[model samples]
Target: MLKRHHKTEALILKASPYGEGHTIVTALTSGGAQLKAMAYGSRKLTSRIGGHLSPLTRVELALYKSRDMDIIKQAQNLESFLELKNSLSRMTKAFFVMELIEGFSNTGVGNRPLFDLSLMSLRGLQSSSNRDIEDLTVSCFQLNLLKVTGFMPELYTCVECRSSLNSNNYNFIIDIGGLCCTKCLSGHPGRAINISSKSVEILRQFDKGGTLFSELPLGSTVELRRLLDSSTGFWLDREIRSRRFMEHMNSRDIREPMSAIDMESV
Candidate 1:
């Protein structure tokens, strides 16, 4: 087979320093494949594509294919998602969005649905006005991501018993991958956390556009966040890298907007 030159639209997933002035750029292409390319001189002040290659920017790239990895020859920025980078909350959530996509994606496989989900989630997080909305946005994205990847947990029925979960008591069992009815709880015997019916209803609303976000109280948001955090953590088998930072910042009272410089560095 012969190597060829190709062009594609990609979102920069990672951009790390590689040799002296070159960088290793990992991107998720529009076709949903991971493209790892070396961008020569991208780290230097006067470099041509230096500004275009940062993580989370959408760009078109000219690549030369190789058995080892593709080499990026030219680049042009399509969108910087500057609005997302303008606030700490937005930036942190954006990073979390990217990390989730990157984590679930195969190294060289194409997953256009997952790719589109990532873009949509980023845009949603950017336009959100309040922290509550922002939190809902992230949870919505997580549930959709699970659906797209075929990991969505069961909500309406007992996962183990194949019976309807119409009763008042239901516990979400991470090990069994869904809610277990009170009658079925004794069968699996792993850690089961009791969940409220309100939480269940709200999570189920995710598949239907999640219009309940605005009406949800602070306690509901906290409950939903905890459920997602635990379920996602259980599935991924590790803590989300962006979670600690997001949680730490979330715990503080930074109601006033942060400076632009801090937003960029975040």
Candidate 2:
């Protein structure tokens, strides 16, 4: 049974201009489905809905069911994540998170845990002030995102033989989605990347729900980033676009700096 009217709490994933002054919004609903709806005249200066439809905003939406797309009749913002928006570095990471969410997520699927995890990750980003902690937040979010989406990498047992992993073996096979033992590495050939024991321990800690960034070595953090980023790209079969901007911003190596408008869009 379909209802004519619908209401839901959603996070605005993206919004684009539509015909005339309207807007096409893509939102991740609280019920865990990706929803697309039209907001008539939302792009106009006088439209009240325009302000609440920006990407990364959490809002309550009132929609009317239509044949092609749902129509947004009303919208009220719930969470603006103002602190996150105020910092450029945090905003870049947040955008990266959103991009990955869209890449791994599918429309019309019941994945409430994914929605909850997404919200939690954003909130975690909002509260953190340290750069190390911020980086850790995004990394932890990615790891949890993988787990929620059923792509969690096996950290303990050998992916090939399902045997207990030995202390000296720390090979993570990106294609196979887990660790490969020394013997299994021979089977996997060049497919395995040799991970340091420190990196492995860090990943294990994340897998076990540890978030404290204190005493975490920078090298290990970078190693984890490379591994997780590669795995995410491999699984999604495409490079995450926002990752480039995030890297650029972090390096602060702007020989060719982005314009103010360009920076704001990111």
Candidate 3:
């Protein structure tokens, strides 16, 4: 009997050129599994899948089971977030978000919450007001991703003694997954990142599902960024390339002049 496989709708998370004229596409299916397949002749100018299979494009695809790799028979475009492509900042942020998802997600894991969060993050990136909002969205996504994946850090209490955290300064142990009160900090050799009260409050808001892209307190944003970056870096065991790109953009933001009107308004 011939083997059988079912078709599914997926969003292309990453894609790269393969062999001579083909392309390898990695996507997150609507069913919440990562799917990898090859789109033959995709590099050719006349290929129908040329523009449709690019990263971040939602597509409906037909797949056939094969011993080595799955075969992509047909592809139809569902939703193309064109705005992300139009602006460099938006594009970079979106790519970074996708990279995080791809890096953390498993091939056959069916996580509906993470899947929904990814889509929501993409939509926020597409329509974000400015770079600040984009940064906050990314931070929020990172926090939520860790939460859904069962890696959410114990931020409210000390990771060591389980005591309530009321300290002005915190020692965040990435491997242990949250703040270590001063007492705990002294015992461990983990890298520590400071956390301010305002930052802790902001994290609490995120834990409570506050609005994405809201006006963030600058201090809070900075602290949250540091916490997430440090935590993710330690847990993932390597630097994420997209994060370096984000840092580059942030540095540029620092050099840009702020309008008097903006300052007065804030």
Q: lDDT winner among the candidates?
A: 2
Q: Give the TM-score of candidate 1.
A: 0.91
- Report the Cα lDDT for candidate 1: 0.83
Question: Which ten contiguous residues of candidate 1 have the minimum total lDDT?
Answer: 257-266
| Backbone clashes in model 3 | 0
- How high a TM-score does candidate 2 get? 0.94
**lDDT values for all models:** 0.83, 0.87, 0.80
**Which candidate wins on TM-score?**
2
Q: What is the TM-score of each candidate against the true structure?
A: 0.91, 0.94, 0.89
Clashes of each: 0, 0, 0
Error of 3 at 73 (Å): 0.8
**Clashing pairs in model 1, backbone N/Cα/C closer than 3 A:** none
Tens digit per residue, CA lDDT, model 1, 9-31: 99998898998999999888998
Tens-digit per-residue lDDT, 1-266, candidate 2:
97999899999988989889999998889987888899999989999999999988999999999999999999999999999888777888899999888887778896899899999999998888777888889889888888989999999899889888877758899988899877778877778888888888888898998765666877888888999999888888999999988887888843345678657656
- Candidate 3, residues 92-195, lDDT tens digits: the string is 77888888788777787877787888889989888998888888888999899888878899888898899977666766777878888887887776477777
Candidates ranked, most accurate by TM-score first: 2, 1, 3
Better of 2 and 3 by lDDT: 2
True-structure lDDT of candidate 3: 0.80
* TM-score: model 3 vs. ground truth: 0.89
